[model samples]
Target: AQSVTQLDSQVPVFEEAPVELRCNYSSSVSVYLFWYVQYPNQGLQLLLKYLSGSTLVESINGFEAEFNKSQTSFHLRKPSVHISDTAEYFCAVKQSGGSYIPTFGRGTSLIVHP
Candidate 1:
Protein backbone atom coordinates (compact mmCIF):
# COMPACT_ATOMS: atom_id res chain seq x y z
CA ALA A 1 0.00 0.00 0.00
CA GLN A 2 1.02 3.60 -0.59
CA SER A 3 0.10 6.97 0.80
CA VAL A 4 0.84 10.53 -0.23
CA THR A 5 1.25 13.60 1.90
CA GLN A 6 1.30 17.22 0.87
CA LEU A 7 3.09 19.14 3.59
CA ASP A 8 1.46 22.49 3.09
CA SER A 9 -2.28 22.97 2.99
CA GLN A 10 -1.90 26.40 1.54
CA VAL A 11 0.99 28.35 0.03
CA PRO A 12 0.70 32.07 -0.65
CA VAL A 13 3.23 33.58 -3.04
CA PHE A 14 3.71 36.67 -5.09
CA GLU A 15 3.57 36.61 -8.83
CA GLU A 16 6.82 35.85 -10.69
CA ALA A 17 8.35 34.38 -7.56
CA PRO A 18 9.62 30.86 -7.23
CA VAL A 19 7.29 28.36 -5.62
CA GLU A 20 7.51 24.80 -4.46
CA LEU A 21 4.77 22.43 -3.28
CA ARG A 22 6.25 19.66 -1.22
CA CYS A 23 5.04 16.09 -1.53
CA ASN A 24 6.13 12.89 0.17
CA TYR A 25 5.05 9.30 -0.06
CA SER A 26 5.37 6.04 1.82
CA SER A 27 5.37 2.65 0.19
CA SER A 28 7.19 -0.63 0.45
CA VAL A 29 7.25 -1.18 -3.29
CA SER A 30 8.35 0.88 -6.25
CA VAL A 31 5.69 3.37 -7.33
CA TYR A 32 4.89 6.14 -9.77
CA LEU A 33 3.52 9.53 -8.84
CA PHE A 34 1.57 12.34 -10.40
CA TRP A 35 0.98 16.00 -9.70
CA TYR A 36 -2.41 17.36 -10.59
CA VAL A 37 -3.60 20.95 -10.65
CA GLN A 38 -7.21 22.02 -10.29
CA TYR A 39 -8.20 25.52 -11.21
CA PRO A 40 -11.30 27.19 -9.85
CA ASN A 41 -14.52 25.71 -11.18
CA GLN A 42 -12.55 23.27 -13.25
CA GLY A 43 -11.53 19.64 -13.11
CA LEU A 44 -8.11 18.45 -12.08
CA GLN A 45 -5.49 18.38 -14.80
CA LEU A 46 -2.27 16.46 -15.03
CA LEU A 47 0.62 18.79 -14.29
CA LEU A 48 3.47 16.35 -14.35
CA LYS A 49 4.39 12.77 -13.56
CA TYR A 50 7.35 10.57 -12.72
CA LEU A 51 7.12 7.02 -13.96
CA SER A 52 10.27 5.17 -15.09
CA GLY A 53 12.54 7.45 -17.02
CA SER A 54 14.72 10.18 -15.55
CA THR A 55 14.05 11.15 -11.98
CA LEU A 56 13.11 14.61 -13.13
CA VAL A 57 10.03 15.45 -15.18
CA GLU A 58 8.61 18.72 -16.48
CA SER A 59 5.26 19.98 -17.67
CA ILE A 60 4.57 22.12 -20.69
CA ASN A 61 3.67 25.06 -18.49
CA GLY A 62 7.13 25.25 -16.89
CA PHE A 63 6.36 23.28 -13.75
CA GLU A 64 8.77 20.53 -12.82
CA ALA A 65 9.01 17.70 -10.33
CA GLU A 66 11.90 15.52 -9.25
CA PHE A 67 11.38 12.04 -7.91
CA ASN A 68 13.89 11.37 -5.14
CA LYS A 69 14.05 7.75 -4.21
CA SER A 70 16.16 8.32 -1.14
CA GLN A 71 13.85 10.90 0.32
CA THR A 72 10.66 9.38 -1.10
CA SER A 73 9.62 12.79 -2.29
CA PHE A 74 8.29 14.26 -5.48
CA HIS A 75 8.15 18.00 -4.91
CA LEU A 76 6.71 20.30 -7.54
CA ARG A 77 8.52 23.52 -8.39
CA LYS A 78 8.05 26.54 -10.61
CA PRO A 79 10.77 29.11 -11.22
CA SER A 80 8.32 31.93 -11.69
CA VAL A 81 4.70 31.67 -10.79
CA HIS A 82 1.85 33.55 -12.39
CA ILE A 83 -1.58 34.66 -11.23
CA SER A 84 -3.10 31.97 -13.33
CA ASP A 85 -1.15 29.42 -11.35
CA THR A 86 -3.40 29.82 -8.38
CA ALA A 87 -5.02 26.46 -7.86
CA GLU A 88 -5.20 23.32 -5.82
CA TYR A 89 -2.39 20.87 -6.31
CA PHE A 90 -2.72 17.21 -5.50
CA CYS A 91 -0.12 14.48 -5.28
CA ALA A 92 -1.04 10.91 -6.08
CA VAL A 93 0.88 7.66 -5.94
CA LYS A 94 0.30 4.19 -7.30
CA GLN A 95 2.36 1.10 -6.67
CA SER A 96 3.84 -0.36 -9.81
CA GLY A 97 1.50 -3.08 -11.15
CA GLY A 98 -0.51 -2.87 -7.99
CA SER A 99 -3.80 -1.14 -8.69
CA TYR A 100 -5.29 1.10 -11.29
CA ILE A 101 -6.34 3.53 -8.58
CA PRO A 102 -3.80 5.84 -6.99
CA THR A 103 -3.73 7.16 -3.49
CA PHE A 104 -4.08 10.93 -3.37
CA GLY A 105 -2.99 13.60 -0.95
CA ARG A 106 -5.23 16.09 0.81
CA GLY A 107 -4.16 18.77 -1.66
CA THR A 108 -2.31 22.09 -1.41
CA SER A 109 -3.83 25.33 -2.45
CA LEU A 110 -1.46 27.77 -4.15
CA ILE A 111 -2.61 31.37 -3.98
CA VAL A 112 -0.59 33.68 -6.18
CA HIS A 113 -0.55 37.35 -5.33
CA PRO A 114 0.26 40.19 -7.66
Candidate 2:
Protein backbone atom coordinates (compact mmCIF):
# COMPACT_ATOMS: atom_id res chain seq x y z
CA ALA A 1 0.00 0.00 0.00
CA GLN A 2 1.11 3.58 -0.63
CA SER A 3 2.27 5.01 2.64
CA VAL A 4 4.09 7.92 4.31
CA THR A 5 5.34 8.06 7.87
CA GLN A 6 5.83 11.15 10.05
CA LEU A 7 8.25 10.43 12.81
CA ASP A 8 7.07 13.06 15.30
CA SER A 9 3.48 13.20 16.41
CA GLN A 10 3.87 16.68 17.83
CA VAL A 11 6.32 19.54 18.25
CA PRO A 12 6.09 22.40 20.73
CA VAL A 13 7.97 25.66 20.47
CA PHE A 14 7.90 29.24 21.68
CA GLU A 15 7.03 32.25 19.63
CA GLU A 16 9.67 33.09 17.02
CA ALA A 17 11.23 29.71 17.53
CA PRO A 18 12.42 27.18 14.98
CA VAL A 19 10.65 23.99 13.94
CA GLU A 20 11.15 20.95 11.81
CA LEU A 21 8.85 18.17 10.62
CA ARG A 22 10.24 14.79 9.72
CA CYS A 23 8.80 12.71 6.88
CA ASN A 24 9.56 9.38 5.24
CA TYR A 25 7.94 7.27 2.57
CA SER A 26 7.96 3.80 1.01
CA SER A 27 6.89 3.00 -2.53
CA SER A 28 7.75 0.49 -5.19
CA VAL A 29 8.07 3.20 -7.81
CA SER A 30 8.96 6.86 -8.10
CA VAL A 31 6.91 9.44 -6.20
CA TYR A 32 6.37 13.15 -5.65
CA LEU A 33 6.83 14.86 -2.34
CA PHE A 34 4.52 17.38 -0.71
CA TRP A 35 4.11 19.19 2.58
CA TYR A 36 0.74 20.54 3.60
CA VAL A 37 -0.12 22.63 6.60
CA GLN A 38 -3.47 22.66 8.37
CA TYR A 39 -4.31 25.58 10.54
CA PRO A 40 -6.59 24.68 13.40
CA ASN A 41 -9.84 23.47 11.82
CA GLN A 42 -8.99 24.72 8.38
CA GLY A 43 -8.02 22.63 5.39
CA LEU A 44 -4.46 21.99 4.31
CA GLN A 45 -2.39 24.28 2.06
CA LEU A 46 0.52 23.13 -0.03
CA LEU A 47 3.76 24.17 1.57
CA LEU A 48 6.21 22.77 -0.93
CA LYS A 49 6.93 19.90 -3.30
CA TYR A 50 9.78 18.00 -4.95
CA LEU A 51 8.63 16.83 -8.33
CA SER A 52 11.44 16.70 -10.92
CA GLY A 53 14.29 19.16 -10.83
CA SER A 54 16.38 19.85 -7.81
CA THR A 55 16.12 17.86 -4.63
CA LEU A 56 15.45 21.06 -2.69
CA VAL A 57 12.05 22.76 -2.54
CA GLU A 58 10.60 25.64 -0.60
CA SER A 59 7.24 27.19 0.00
CA ILE A 60 6.38 30.85 -0.27
CA ASN A 61 5.80 30.88 3.44
CA GLY A 62 9.45 30.50 4.41
CA PHE A 63 9.52 26.72 4.85
CA GLU A 64 11.79 24.41 2.95
CA ALA A 65 12.55 20.72 2.49
CA GLU A 66 15.04 18.53 0.74
CA PHE A 67 14.30 15.28 -1.03
CA ASN A 68 16.88 12.65 -0.25
CA LYS A 69 16.71 9.64 -2.54
CA SER A 70 19.21 7.58 -0.65
CA GLN A 71 17.37 7.92 2.63
CA THR A 72 13.89 8.00 1.11
CA SER A 73 13.10 11.02 3.19
CA PHE A 74 11.82 14.57 2.80
CA HIS A 75 12.15 16.54 5.97
CA LEU A 76 10.83 20.08 6.46
CA ARG A 77 12.60 22.90 8.22
CA LYS A 78 12.17 26.52 9.25
CA PRO A 79 14.92 28.62 10.72
CA SER A 80 12.44 30.39 13.00
CA VAL A 81 8.76 29.90 13.71
CA HIS A 82 5.95 32.11 14.78
CA ILE A 83 2.78 31.60 16.78
CA SER A 84 0.95 31.88 13.51
CA ASP A 85 2.82 28.77 12.45
CA THR A 86 1.06 26.68 15.00
CA ALA A 87 -0.89 24.01 13.19
CA GLU A 88 -1.01 20.44 12.02
CA TYR A 89 1.57 19.50 9.40
CA PHE A 90 1.18 16.57 7.07
CA CYS A 91 3.68 14.90 4.78
CA ALA A 92 2.36 13.34 1.60
CA VAL A 93 3.53 11.40 -1.44
CA LYS A 94 2.02 10.73 -4.85
CA GLN A 95 3.01 8.10 -7.37
CA SER A 96 4.26 8.59 -10.91
CA GLY A 97 1.27 7.25 -12.84
CA GLY A 98 -0.96 10.03 -11.45
CA SER A 99 -3.21 7.12 -10.54
CA TYR A 100 -2.31 7.23 -6.90
CA ILE A 101 -3.85 9.76 -4.60
CA PRO A 102 -1.59 11.45 -2.10
CA THR A 103 -1.00 9.43 1.03
CA PHE A 104 -0.65 11.63 4.10
CA GLY A 105 1.15 10.89 7.28
CA ARG A 106 -0.56 10.76 10.68
CA GLY A 107 0.42 14.47 11.06
CA THR A 108 2.46 16.42 13.54
CA SER A 109 0.85 19.12 15.64
CA LEU A 110 3.05 22.16 16.21
CA ILE A 111 2.24 24.12 19.31
CA VAL A 112 3.59 27.63 19.69
CA HIS A 113 3.75 29.12 23.13
CA PRO A 114 3.65 32.79 23.73
Candidate 3:
Protein backbone atom coordinates (compact mmCIF):
# COMPACT_ATOMS: atom_id res chain seq x y z
CA ALA A 1 0.00 0.00 0.00
CA GLN A 2 1.10 3.60 -0.50
CA SER A 3 1.86 5.01 2.89
CA VAL A 4 4.28 6.90 5.10
CA THR A 5 5.28 5.94 8.62
CA GLN A 6 6.58 8.25 11.27
CA LEU A 7 8.58 6.46 13.93
CA ASP A 8 7.81 8.81 16.81
CA SER A 9 4.28 9.92 17.44
CA GLN A 10 5.37 12.55 19.90
CA VAL A 11 8.57 14.20 21.04
CA PRO A 12 9.01 16.39 24.13
CA VAL A 13 12.05 18.57 24.59
CA PHE A 14 13.16 21.63 26.47
CA GLU A 15 13.28 24.96 24.71
CA GLU A 16 16.37 25.46 22.55
CA ALA A 17 17.01 21.72 22.43
CA PRO A 18 17.53 19.85 19.22
CA VAL A 19 15.08 17.31 17.81
CA GLU A 20 14.64 14.84 15.00
CA LEU A 21 11.54 13.15 13.60
CA ARG A 22 11.97 9.91 11.75
CA CYS A 23 9.97 9.04 8.63
CA ASN A 24 9.82 6.07 6.32
CA TYR A 25 7.75 5.30 3.27
CA SER A 26 6.91 2.35 1.06
CA SER A 27 5.91 2.95 -2.51
CA SER A 28 5.84 0.92 -5.68
CA VAL A 29 7.10 3.75 -7.87
CA SER A 30 8.93 7.03 -7.66
CA VAL A 31 7.40 9.60 -5.36
CA TYR A 32 7.68 13.23 -4.37
CA LEU A 33 8.74 13.90 -0.79
CA PHE A 34 7.49 16.61 1.51
CA TRP A 35 7.45 17.68 5.13
CA TYR A 36 4.71 19.94 6.40
CA VAL A 37 4.28 21.70 9.72
CA GLN A 38 1.03 22.63 11.38
CA TYR A 39 0.68 24.93 14.33
CA PRO A 40 -2.24 24.79 16.70
CA ASN A 41 -5.48 25.86 15.08
CA GLN A 42 -3.89 26.45 11.72
CA GLY A 43 -3.47 24.88 8.31
CA LEU A 44 -0.47 22.88 7.27
CA GLN A 45 2.51 24.73 5.78
CA LEU A 46 5.17 23.28 3.54
CA LEU A 47 8.44 22.95 5.45
CA LEU A 48 10.55 21.32 2.78
CA LYS A 49 10.47 18.96 -0.15
CA TYR A 50 12.74 16.64 -2.11
CA LEU A 51 11.45 16.77 -5.67
CA SER A 52 14.42 15.93 -7.85
CA GLY A 53 18.04 16.72 -7.19
CA SER A 54 20.50 16.12 -4.43
CA THR A 55 18.93 13.93 -1.80
CA LEU A 56 19.30 16.65 0.83
CA VAL A 57 16.77 19.47 1.18
CA GLU A 58 16.13 22.34 3.59
CA SER A 59 13.26 24.57 4.54
CA ILE A 60 13.19 28.32 4.69
CA ASN A 61 13.23 27.97 8.42
CA GLY A 62 16.02 25.96 9.99
CA PHE A 63 14.66 22.47 9.34
CA GLU A 64 16.31 20.09 6.92
CA ALA A 65 16.10 16.51 5.75
CA GLU A 66 17.62 14.05 3.33
CA PHE A 67 15.78 11.73 0.98
CA ASN A 68 17.33 8.27 0.92
CA LYS A 69 16.16 6.16 -1.97
CA SER A 70 17.91 3.03 -0.84
CA GLN A 71 16.38 3.05 2.63
CA THR A 72 13.14 4.69 1.48
CA SER A 73 13.32 7.21 4.29
CA PHE A 74 13.24 10.94 4.91
CA HIS A 75 14.07 12.19 8.36
CA LEU A 76 13.62 15.76 9.53
CA ARG A 77 16.04 17.54 11.87
CA LYS A 78 16.45 20.90 13.53
CA PRO A 79 19.17 22.19 15.84
CA SER A 80 18.67 24.59 18.75
CA VAL A 81 14.93 24.67 18.43
CA HIS A 82 12.76 27.29 20.05
CA ILE A 83 9.54 26.95 21.98
CA SER A 84 7.81 28.52 19.02
CA ASP A 85 8.80 25.44 17.05
CA THR A 86 6.33 23.34 18.98
CA ALA A 87 3.94 21.93 16.41
CA GLU A 88 2.83 18.86 14.53
CA TYR A 89 4.94 17.64 11.64
CA PHE A 90 3.82 15.33 8.87
CA CYS A 91 5.71 13.38 6.25
CA ALA A 92 3.97 12.89 2.93
CA VAL A 93 4.52 11.21 -0.41
CA LYS A 94 2.91 11.58 -3.81
CA GLN A 95 3.35 8.78 -6.23
CA SER A 96 4.53 9.49 -9.74
CA GLY A 97 1.86 9.25 -12.49
CA GLY A 98 -0.79 9.32 -9.83
CA SER A 99 -3.04 11.81 -8.10
CA TYR A 100 -1.42 14.89 -6.63
CA ILE A 101 -2.89 14.17 -3.22
CA PRO A 102 -0.19 12.93 -0.92
CA THR A 103 -0.40 10.16 1.61
CA PHE A 104 0.76 11.46 4.97
CA GLY A 105 2.09 9.83 8.06
CA ARG A 106 0.09 9.87 11.25
CA GLY A 107 2.15 12.88 12.33
CA THR A 108 4.79 13.69 14.94
CA SER A 109 3.94 16.19 17.61
CA LEU A 110 6.78 18.33 18.92
CA ILE A 111 6.50 19.80 22.40
CA VAL A 112 8.97 22.52 23.27
CA HIS A 113 9.39 23.49 26.90
CA PRO A 114 9.99 26.96 28.19
Candidate 4:
Protein backbone atom coordinates (compact mmCIF):
# COMPACT_ATOMS: atom_id res chain seq x y z
CA ALA A 1 0.00 0.00 0.00
CA GLN A 2 1.11 3.55 -0.65
CA SER A 3 0.04 7.00 0.49
CA VAL A 4 0.99 10.52 -0.59
CA THR A 5 1.39 13.69 1.41
CA GLN A 6 1.57 17.28 0.14
CA LEU A 7 3.14 19.37 2.86
CA ASP A 8 1.65 22.64 1.73
CA SER A 9 -1.88 23.30 0.58
CA GLN A 10 -0.85 26.50 -1.17
CA VAL A 11 2.37 28.22 -2.17
CA PRO A 12 2.52 31.87 -3.15
CA VAL A 13 5.42 33.14 -5.23
CA PHE A 14 6.32 36.05 -7.45
CA GLU A 15 7.02 35.82 -11.12
CA GLU A 16 10.69 35.03 -11.87
CA ALA A 17 11.23 33.79 -8.35
CA PRO A 18 12.13 30.23 -7.46
CA VAL A 19 9.71 27.96 -5.67
CA GLU A 20 9.49 24.50 -4.21
CA LEU A 21 6.53 22.19 -3.62
CA ARG A 22 7.10 19.56 -1.00
CA CYS A 23 5.82 16.00 -1.23
CA ASN A 24 6.33 12.89 0.89
CA TYR A 25 5.05 9.35 0.56
CA SER A 26 5.18 5.95 2.22
CA SER A 27 4.77 2.43 0.86
CA SER A 28 5.63 -1.09 1.86
CA VAL A 29 6.62 -2.00 -1.67
CA SER A 30 8.81 -0.40 -4.28
CA VAL A 31 6.98 2.43 -6.08
CA TYR A 32 7.23 4.97 -8.85
CA LEU A 33 7.02 8.67 -8.14
CA PHE A 34 5.38 11.33 -10.28
CA TRP A 35 4.48 14.98 -10.36
CA TYR A 36 1.44 16.40 -12.13
CA VAL A 37 0.27 19.91 -12.72
CA GLN A 38 -3.26 21.23 -13.24
CA TYR A 39 -3.84 24.60 -14.76
CA PRO A 40 -6.98 26.14 -13.38
CA ASN A 41 -9.98 23.99 -14.38
CA GLN A 42 -8.06 22.01 -16.96
CA GLY A 43 -7.05 18.39 -16.59
CA LEU A 44 -3.89 17.16 -14.94
CA GLN A 45 -0.74 16.93 -17.04
CA LEU A 46 2.26 14.67 -16.50
CA LEU A 47 5.11 16.83 -15.38
CA LEU A 48 7.81 14.30 -14.58
CA LYS A 49 8.37 10.81 -13.22
CA TYR A 50 10.94 8.55 -11.56
CA LEU A 51 10.47 5.05 -12.84
CA SER A 52 13.78 3.18 -12.57
CA GLY A 53 17.33 4.44 -12.60
CA SER A 54 18.53 7.93 -11.80
CA THR A 55 16.76 9.46 -8.83
CA LEU A 56 16.75 12.89 -10.47
CA VAL A 57 14.02 13.75 -12.98
CA GLU A 58 13.00 16.88 -14.81
CA SER A 59 10.18 18.29 -16.86
CA ILE A 60 10.47 20.13 -20.16
CA ASN A 61 9.16 23.27 -18.53
CA GLY A 62 12.17 23.67 -16.23
CA PHE A 63 10.70 21.94 -13.18
CA GLU A 64 12.70 19.20 -11.52
CA ALA A 65 12.19 16.75 -8.71
CA GLU A 66 14.52 14.39 -6.91
CA PHE A 67 13.37 11.08 -5.56
CA ASN A 68 14.89 10.41 -2.14
CA LYS A 69 14.52 6.83 -1.07
CA SER A 70 15.94 7.41 2.38
CA GLN A 71 13.52 10.20 3.22
CA THR A 72 10.69 8.98 1.01
CA SER A 73 10.38 12.40 -0.55
CA PHE A 74 9.93 13.84 -4.01
CA HIS A 75 10.08 17.58 -3.84
CA LEU A 76 9.43 19.71 -6.95
CA ARG A 77 11.40 22.85 -7.61
CA LYS A 78 11.73 25.46 -10.33
CA PRO A 79 14.68 27.81 -10.58
CA SER A 80 12.47 30.59 -11.87
CA VAL A 81 8.77 31.13 -12.31
CA HIS A 82 6.26 32.76 -14.60
CA ILE A 83 2.68 33.84 -14.08
CA SER A 84 1.67 31.01 -16.37
CA ASP A 85 3.31 28.61 -13.95
CA THR A 86 0.43 29.16 -11.58
CA ALA A 87 -1.41 25.93 -11.08
CA GLU A 88 -2.18 23.12 -8.67
CA TYR A 89 0.53 20.50 -8.32
CA PHE A 90 0.02 16.91 -7.29
CA CYS A 91 2.44 14.29 -6.05
CA ALA A 92 1.68 10.65 -6.68
CA VAL A 93 3.02 7.19 -5.92
CA LYS A 94 2.16 3.88 -7.53
CA GLN A 95 3.04 0.33 -6.65
CA SER A 96 5.87 -0.78 -8.96
CA GLY A 97 4.04 -3.85 -10.14
CA GLY A 98 0.67 -5.52 -10.46
CA SER A 99 -1.82 -2.66 -10.23
CA TYR A 100 -1.29 0.78 -11.74
CA ILE A 101 -3.46 2.79 -9.42
CA PRO A 102 -1.55 5.71 -7.89
CA THR A 103 -2.19 7.50 -4.64
CA PHE A 104 -2.31 11.27 -5.11
CA GLY A 105 -1.71 14.08 -2.71
CA ARG A 106 -4.36 16.67 -1.83
CA GLY A 107 -2.63 19.05 -4.28
CA THR A 108 -0.68 22.20 -3.62
CA SER A 109 -1.94 25.32 -5.34
CA LEU A 110 0.88 27.54 -6.68
CA ILE A 111 -0.26 31.08 -7.11
CA VAL A 112 2.20 33.29 -8.93
CA HIS A 113 1.92 37.02 -8.54
CA PRO A 114 3.35 39.70 -10.76
Estimate, for each residue in 2-104, the C-alpha lDDT of model 4 and write its tens digit.
Answer: 8999999999999999999999999999999999999978999999999989999999999999999999999999999999999999999999966689999
Tens digits of lDDT, candidate 2, 1-114: 568999999999888878888999998889998999999778999989898999989888789999998999999999888888999999999897576788999999989899
Off by over 4 Å in 3: 97-99
Decoy 3 TM-score against native: 0.94
TM of each candidate vs. truth: 0.97, 0.94, 0.94, 0.97
**Could you give candidate 3's per-residue lDDT for residues 60-101 as a string of tens digits?**
789999999999999999987988899999999998755678
lDDT of 1 by residue, 45-100 (tens): 99998889899999999999999999999999999999999999999999886456
Q: Tell me which residue pairs clash in candidate 1.
A: none
How displaced is residue 82 in candidate 2, in Å? 0.5
Candidate 2's C-alpha runs over 4 A off are: none
Give the CA lDDT, 0 to 100, for residue 61 in model 1.
Answer: 97
Q: State how far residue 65 of model 3 sits from its true place (Å).
A: 0.7
Runs of candidate 4 with Cα error greater than 4 angstroms are: none
The candidate, 3 or 4, that scores higher on TM-score is 4
